[model samples]
Target: MTTASGGWTVIQHRYDGSVGFYRNLSEYTDGFGNVGTEFWLGLSYIKEIADKGNTTIRMEVSAADGSSAYEEWPEFRLGDAPTYTLHVGGRGIGTAGDSVRYFEQGNNGSDFTATGSYCGDIQHGAWWHNSYCTYINLNGEYATPGTRSRYDNGWGGMVYFSFKDKSSLKMSTIMIRRND
Candidate 1:
C-alpha cells in the first residue's frame, strides 16, 4: 500500500512461506492467514469492495535472481458468489506481459477455482483460472529461489512464466484501488 497513487488495498500478498496458499474452498471464501504477512483478503469481501466502484488491479512479482515484473489492468472486478469470476478489462503496460485477461477463446471471465483440483493442484493454489492455467499464479506453494524442481509436475509453486520463464517466484503481491 505504499504507492504514489496511494489508498491501495492489498488483496493478496506473499513473500515467504509464512502462510500457506494451498487452501480449500471454504478457506478461500472465508480467507486465512495474517494480512501483515502472506494472505488472501477473501472472496466475498473482494467482490463487495470491487463492485462498489471502478477499480484497477496491480500484480507485482519478483524472481529469485533479483529480477522483478508487474502487470496492471485499467479495470478489474469479481463476479457474484458460487463463483467469484474474474473480469480483467485490458492490459496497461509493464515488464511482465499482460496475461491476466485472455481475450481469445478463453474470454475474460474466469471462475475462482478451489485449490487441490485440476490446474490448481498441479500449479499449487487457487484463483480465477482458465482451462489452460499458469498465465499468472501468485497463490502458490512458497519455495526458496533455487530449492525447487524444473519439471512440469514440480511446478506446484508460484509461477509467472512471463517473468523470465520463472515457475517459482521469490515474491509476489496483488493490490487493487478504486479508479474513481
Candidate 2:
C-alpha cells in the first residue's frame, strides 16, 4: 500500500490458500478472512466508502517467481446491496491491461453475483461477473502452480486473465483510496 497517500484501504488481499475464497453470497456480503492476511473487506464496506466520495482502485497481481503487474482506475463506485452492482469508469492504467474493463463490452456495470458463481459456468468463486464472466477473477479458487493445468480450461483459480491468459496467480491485492 502506498503510504504516501493515506486512507488507502485494502479491499482484498491473498498470498496463499490459507483462507478459502470460494464462498457464498452471504459470506461475500459480510466479508471473510483476516485483514492481516488473506481477506476481502466486504461489499457493504466497499459501498459505504465509495458513497462517501470519489475513489480510485488499484489492483496488483504477482506470480510465484515474484514477477508482478498492477492496474489502476481513476474512478470507481460500488452500488448498494441486493444487486451490489459495480461501476468502474475510465481506462485503467497499469501493467494488468485493464482486464476488468475489457470483458465483453465491459464488466463495469456487472452485478455482484455469487450463486452458481464464476459466470454460472463453474464454481471458481463469487465475483462481480458480467453474466458470462469477468476477465479478472481474483476471488477465484487458489490453485497452486502445479495444480493449474487441471483448471486452466475453466478458469478455476485466482487469476487475472489478461496478465497471462488465465495464468495462475501467487498473490494479489486490491486497494481503494478516496479522492475527497
For all candidates, what are the clash counts?
Answer: 0, 0
Tens digits of lDDT, candidate 1, 63-113: 887888877776788888878878877666676865543421252577888
Clashing residue pairs in candidate 2 are none
The 10-residue segment of model 1 with minimum total lDDT is: 98-107
Looking at model 1, residue 22 earns an lDDT score of: 81
TM-scores for all predictions: 0.88, 0.89
TM-score of 2: 0.89
Task: List, residue by residue over 1-180, the lDDT tens digit for candidate 2.
Answer: 454356789999998889988777788888999988899888998889888888888888898667888887867888878778888777888887655556324677888887565463373677778755767778878888424524437476777777766767888898999987
Tell me the deviation in Å of residue 20 in model 2. 0.4
Q: CA shift at 138, candidate 1, in angstroms?
A: 0.8
Candidate 1 — number of clashing residue pairs? 0
